[model samples]
Target: MESDDLSSLSEKKLKKLINETQDVLDQLKAELKQRKLDRQHHEIDHMEDYFEDAEHNLSNLRLFIQKVFSEIRKR
Candidate 1:
């Protein structure tokens, strides 16, 4: 969702969104950790690029969630 749309949400809704976003971030981190463990067993080939992409996206998601929380705090 756009920042404008996010800014328009009610405080309760915004808090809920922040919680959901955090959950997603946690899942992504868990997935990355599992991928690293699986790599030790050679379960996947050429996964470095995939992991890098995931990390980048996860960083962006974290920033977005931070922005949402910042907005919530401003209310």
Candidate 2:
């Protein structure tokens, strides 16, 4: 929140907003902890490998397109 917006709130409202924000933060931390305990390290690594392979494939495709365009320009 911007300081100007916060400054406009009454003290009681500000305190309430703070409490609500803390509750959300606590809930998010708990969810993340649960997710961490549930996922295996190897599964995450496999996802990363898939992303790397996709990136390599796209790079190769870009080069292939450039070569094809270069050949077309000679006609």
Candidate 3:
């Protein structure tokens, strides 16, 4: 959703969205951690690129989450 669309949501709905986004962020973090651990024990070709992509996506998600949070606080 766009920032404008998000800004239009009711406080209750916004809080729910925030919670859901947080859950997703948590899951991504766990997956990234696990991937790193697994890579350490096994030799996987081109695994570094996978990790880089995952980290990049995670960072974007985090920024989006932060924006949502800031919107919530504005209420």
What tens-digit string does per-residue lDDT give for candidate 1 at 14-46?
999899999999999999999989886674576
What C-alpha lDDT values do all the predictions have? 0.89, 0.89, 0.90
lDDT of 2 by residue, 29-60 (tens): 99998888667665776797878777788789
Off by over 4 Å in 3: 43-75
- Estimate the TM-score of every prediction: 0.51, 0.52, 0.53
lDDT of 3 by residue, 28-57 (tens): 999999999888767567778778777688
Q: In candidate 1, how many Å is residue 50 off?
A: 24
Off by over 4 Å in 2: 40-75
Q: What is the C-alpha RMSD of each candidate to the true structure, in Å?
A: 20.7, 7.3, 20.5
How many backbone clashes can be found in candidate 2? 0
Give me the displacement of residue 17 in model 2, in angstroms. 0.5
TM-score of 3: 0.53
